[model samples]
Target chain A: MSFLELRGITRDWDGQGGVRDISLSLQRGDFLSILGPSGCGKSTLLRLIAGLEQPQHGTVVIDGRDVTALPPAQRNLSMVFQSYALFPHLNVAENVMFGLKVRRVAARERDRRLSDALKMTGLDGLERRKPAELSGGQRQRVALARAAVAEKPLCLMDEPLSNLDAKLRHSVRRDIRALARNLGLTVVYVTHDQGEAMSLSDTVALMNKGQVEQVGPPSTLYNQPATIFAAQFIGEPPMALVEGPLLGLREGLTVGLRPELIQLSPPEQAHLTARVLDCEFLGSETLVSLDHPAGQGLAVVLPGHASQVPGDSVGVILPEQDRRIFDTHSGRIEKASQQNPAALNRQNTAPRDGQTAPEATEPSFDLNRTTS
Target chain B: MAGPRAIQGPAMTDPLKLERRRRAIHGWLLLSPALAMLTVFALYPSVATFWTSLWSRGTRRNPSEFIGLENYRALLEDPTFWKVVWNNLLYAGVTIPASIAIALIMALWANSRIPARSFIRTAYFTPTVLPMIAAGNLWLFFYTPSFGILNKIGALFGAPSVNWLGQPDTALWAICIVTIWKEAGFFMVFYLAALQTIPPDLKEAAEIEGASRWTYLRRIVLPLLMPTTLFIFVNAMINSVKLIDHLFILTKGGPSDSSKLILYYIWENAFAYFDRPAAAAMTIFVLIVLGLLAAFQFLVLERRTHYQ
Candidate 1:
């Protein structure tokens, strides 16, 4: 059995959308992130697992025991809320020791655990100050210390770093990940930022409307998205999805390609020609927006500065193997061999100078092109 | 060069200085009416009261004479004055904490997801809207000895009939109960507002931290409502002295001055017995007590509670 399992959980309060029939299993020490937009039921799923909100229909089995009817206090899980939710009346030390005092832990042990937690979160010296006296980052650390001192096996965090500035967010994100790893605690983190989900979690569950669209390791979800929504929601600048023959594909099909896969080349060596509409010069890379005759718009990412301006006509080349084809009607992936007849015919009639023909007899056409 | 610049600086500032003086005069002119009203109504009466307390009452045959500290000495020596002081102190001691505690309970219940929440809230606050004398008359029927509802209920339980407001031992307590009922609802509105301001997430956090409901209330909810508690406490204390309207309708400070609060005693001395000097002395004493209480709350108690 998995260490923690949620079996067919469904909670709908207003006949509106809530988490519906969701099930997940986590191993010991695994970090899972439920990532989605606001009002997408990501936080509701976390609350159900924390036992703050009881699922109308489901069993939450933790460590081989069903705790479906248990209250939050009886579930033995610690949560770090989005608002920090530190007690304003209590100082730093008292806030950290609150859970232990509630459980009636020995004073000596409480002191030891509180000191360790404070030290780990780098809140050692400021134990006497109230939450109002601390900076935003310091208050966030105190919230983390409060949860950490509980020493529970499972920790749930609901966008704990969403209130911090960009620089402070980065540092606190690292601390949370480190704390989870070092303590060997199973953590279910919720975030709307895809970057935080992708970098910090071992497995990312991308939720849409009330269901999980995809659940896998971060790389698998990014490189081999199962649906059109997954592909568009995963990356920075998102994947460039073009319909009808942009990549020499058939009609009634959409081809998904990452921006970094398309390159600007000479017209003679390119498969499609397009005009650059805009270029955003990010510090590390330039994202160039291209307009094609067949599709709405396509984005191409190049490393460092690319000397391309608006209205500049450029040839676009897809590195044959880096394309993902999906059915337009169902939004499901169509295997390269069965779906792309034009590419197949091109492979048999004439092989390009530098490109090899795709293997015709390969049994299952892989959707992702693993570059490295 | 410095002499010419210095001489020209004042010359250039003349118009600005004149403008500032004109604005100041305009501001004071606008404020003169309000200042005059305050001096006539509040400041002047308070000073005249203090001055009157220093003189002895004048009879028709003799003119009023200054008797510095004699009224103060008479107040100290009077046994009835001491009894009334003790009664007011006891009234404050019993009503302040009891009203606050009951108000907090009412607030918690009204704020919870109980059925008929709005109805319960309105019922709890009904006494606050009713005039104190009206409420006092309403309770007077309930405490009317043989024919009263309380005695009727006591008869059903095989208990002997007892006088609720007639006896010295129960009169003050009976009045205390009435004061608590009347003021608890008024104070409940403040507690309810404070309780509503507490974030729901804090309660959820406490629950996830394994705190029981009682523990959460004691350790988190009550501590967070400290500022509201202090505010309500001051209001309740002032009401205990000021709100003697019920005494006129219910007990009349009767049965030998058992339940006479300070304000009622001051009214009797000034209007009933025609003793203005004694009434003025008592009024000054009440003012000193109120001032000290305000200072104690702001300076001492406020420092102990966290606000925000």
Candidate 2:
């Protein structure tokens, strides 16, 4: 059984606040990253599980108990905040011992645990140093040490690496993720950084407008998005959306293609012709923006060493298997060969009395490439 | 060896340099009024007081005698002076911690998620802006022997009504209570400003670490407020020493001089007894004591500046 569960949790706040319904579960040692843009209520989900904020409805089940009504102290879960929030007055040792002290653990046991936590964070020799005396990276470790000393089965992180510089966030995030795994802890990490979500999570819950758009392994979320929002949100530089009729497909089917998946063909070897509108030379990859006269605009990422310039005519090709088709009206994926062009044209033209499908319409495609 | 030294430069001793020097002189000329007033009002009095401390009890006209350390010796021997010092000590003991505790509690309550926080803050701070004499009068009514609001309420609870400021044993305490009521709200403003600067993420971190609210306060809030606490403590001590306005209205140096502060005693020696030289000597002594206290506080601050 999963060790933690949020069952139909809906929190509705007042005054311009939105409602969020989040139902998820985590098994022991599972690491879940809640990734979203700001104001998407990812932090609210963490707070609900921690009992910092009660959901307007639904229960939080931990192990087997309904702990939704319990206070944060009773939840037996440790959290790391974005600011690290180490106690400025207490030395590193005392900070790690704070939870143990409050629980009235024996002094000897508290000291032993504190030392162990310090050693794990590589802060063993700096036990006597106050928080202000430590660097930003050191403070982050102390906060982790403080949480780790609790030995709680569950942990929560609210953008804990947001304060560190790019270089430090890179290392500290790995350290914290390793700490969670080594301790066999179940962690729910919240962040807007897609990179962090992709790198550290066993499961990633992509959120939008206070709801989970999709939940899956990183590779699955990237390769197979369930919705347009998920497809656009999960990838860097976003997915290029191209709209037009499908050439080899039936009606009510719209095709989607990834930038790198679309190949640039030679003029003589061209499968389809597209106008090269612009090109960008990134260090390792060259991004070429192509426009199809009848199809949607597309971006193609070529090797950076390519000598393609803007306004050049190019040929494009896609193997039949790489094409993705979605329902024209509902934006849901449909089988490519099962659609009817006549019925699709009627559906598209019935709304416009004067316009019939341009009889000689040609299908075009879009390509959007992301380096990572 | 150098081919030709640059031509004798007139820029180093340029006439424009003289013009700029002239402008600097004019700037001081424009500031002379405020400078003269500062010299006359601040420096002259301080120097005069130090000089007068060397003389004995002297009249405004001609009664004068040189008594080098005799006034200092007399000050050491005076039992009443020691009692006044002891009373000040007792006053400080009662008021400093009380006011600081009340201020901190009020700041925290105002800063936290408690409901009606704005209303509570306004009520607490209203007393600070009121005239001290008016506050003293209001407290006097509460401390009345009988029929006062406090005694009336006490009697309703079946407790006996007793003298609050009428007895020497309780007079200093009565004044301390009024002083705390009049001043704690003022100190609370400083603490409120400090509390707002503490990042909310820190407290959330503690909560996530499985710390209770009380533990968070003891381990996080209190330590973060240390610099502000020290600031309020030293300033409160200084204000209590100089705050004789309410003492004049409420106790008037008390039923038996039990509420006499050092400044009030100095006032009596100078104006009431017409002892100019004695007052000057006492003034110098008080300045030394206050100077020493300030220096001690500075040392403490310098040692802990890292946290700030």
Candidate 3:
């Protein structure tokens, strides 16, 4: 048995919005990120595991114990809330030591843990300041320090960085990662930001509309997105999709092309011509946004500042071998042969996964390659 | 307009000096209205009352004269005045804490996700909306001798029909109960507002840290409510001496003035007894005590409560 397991979990309000039939497991030290857009039930799944929200039907097993009916405190886990939720009245030291005092831990042990957690979060000197007196980053650190001092094995975080500015967010993310690694904590972090999920976790469970779309390592999700939603959702300037029939493929299929893979060529020697709408100069690479006759918004990633003027016609070389074809009706990736739509690729075998929970053991095929 | 620094144009004058003069004039202009109103309504009456307290009562035959603290000296020596002071103290002590406690409990109940929550909140707040005189009259019906609702209910339990308002023993306590009932609902509004300002996330965070519901209330909710508590406390304190309307309808400070509070006694000294000097003396006493107590409360509690 795994250290934590959620088997057949289903919790839906009004038959919608909440998570549905999510089954996942993690080892003692695994860091799993439930990643999706807002309202995708990612936070719902994390809350269920934290025992904050009870699954209408499922068994939650934690460390060989069936804790499905247990209260949150009894589940022996700590959570960092998005609001930081620091007690306004208590200073930093008291806030961090709240849980320890609640459990009747001795004063000496409590002091040691409190000091260590504060030092770990860089909140050492601000111990006597109330939460209102601290900066937003410092308040966020106090919340982290509270979660850490508990010394719980499993930690759940719900968009904890959403409250901080970009600069502070990265530094806090580093602190969280360091704390988790040093403590060997099994963390189930819920976030809508793909970059945060990919950069932080060992495994990423991509969710859409209350179910897991695909679950695997960051590389697998980035490359071999198992569904159209995953392909469009998981990358910066995500995969550009177009009507398959416009590209001389089957009429009812949709074709996906990675922004970095689409090559710009001379108008006479290409698959299609698209008018450049604008160009964005993003320090390391430039994204040339184009309006294709068949595709609404497609962008091509070019390395190191390729500035193109708007309204210029450019040849878009969408390589046939790199195209990911999907059944438009189902939104799941199809296994079509790499070139000339020869046949369904043998790699994407299970069609049933499109409609239900996928067996995301990790993909066997390299689904995406960054070629820019 | 006769504005400040009208003698010179801006470019012709020292800019910093002109700006400072303009700001000072603007500041005084802004303050004039509120200051004028407070002077006429609050400050003038307080000073007049103090001035009256130092003089002797006037008769048509002999005009009033300054006796200098003679009325205050009489107040200290009178038995009824002492009794009224004790009654007022008991009234404030009972009603302030009792109403505040009941308000907090009611606010917590109404703030939670319960069946017909809005209905519960409205029901709790109903007493506050009714005029104090109307509430007094309403309670008058319940405190009436044999036919009152309370005695009627007590009869079912084989109890005798007690004269709740007519007797001296239960008279003050009966008034205390009515004040608590009237004021708790009003204070609950402040408490409910405070409770809503507290994010739901705090409770979840506390629960995740293994704090029980009671623990959360003690550590999180109560401390956060301290500001509202202090505000409500000051209001409830003033109300104890302030709300004497029900006394007018129900007891009228009868049964040898047993239920007579300080405010009622002051009114009696001025109108019924025709002793304006005595009433002014008592009014000054009440004002000094309330001022000192309010100042003490702010100094002591402002340090402890967290304000946003």
lDDT of 1 by residue, B86-141 (tens): 99999999999999999999999999999999999999999999987789999998
Predicted complex 3: CAPRI docking category: medium
Compare candidates 1 and 3 on TM-score and give the better one: 3
TM-score of each: 0.90, 0.85, 0.91
Q: Could you report the DockQ of all the candidates, in the order they appear? A: 0.72, 0.54, 0.79
lDDT-sorted candidate list, best first: 3, 1, 2
DockQ of 2: 0.54
Tens-digit lDDT track of model 3 for A1-372: 589998999999989799888999898999999999999899889889888889999899999999999999999999998888888889999999999999999999999999999889999899999998999999999999999999999999999999889999899899989999999999999999999999999999999889999999998888888887888889888888765655666555677888889998876666666778899999999999987645634789999989788877777777777788876667777776623454322122111213221222222212232110
In candidate 3 the C-alpha lDDT for residue B162 amounts to 90
lDDT of 3 by residue, B1-308 (tens): 34454534556378776777687678778889999999999999999999999999999997899999889889999999999989989988898899999999999999999999999999999998999888998998898878899989999998898999999999999999998898899999999999999998889888888889999999899999999999999888888888668888999987788999999999999999899999999999999999999998999988877898
Which one wins by lDDT: 1 or 2? 1
Error of 2 at A31 (Å): 2.3
List the global CA lDDT of all models. Answer: 0.85, 0.77, 0.85
* lDDT of each residue in A73-190, candidate 1, tens digit only: 8777899999999999999999999989999999999999999999999998999999999999999999999989999998999999899999999999999999998888899999
TM-score of chain A of 3: 0.89
The residue-by-residue lDDT of candidate 2 on B1-308, one tens digit each, is 11122233346477766566566667777788988999999889988987777787765685777888877788779887888889999999889999999999988888888888889889889999998788888988999988888899999999899888888988898899888887789889889998998888777766766667787887777877888888888888888778788778878897788889888988888888877767788888888888898898879774764364
Least well predicted 10-residue stretch by lDDT in candidate 2 chain B: B1-10
Ranking of predictions according to DockQ: 3, 1, 2
- Greater DockQ among 2 and 3 belongs to 3
Off by over 4 Å in 2: A15-19, A104-116, A246-254, A266-278, A291-297, A328-331, A335-372, B1-43, B60-63, B144-147, B151-167, B301-306
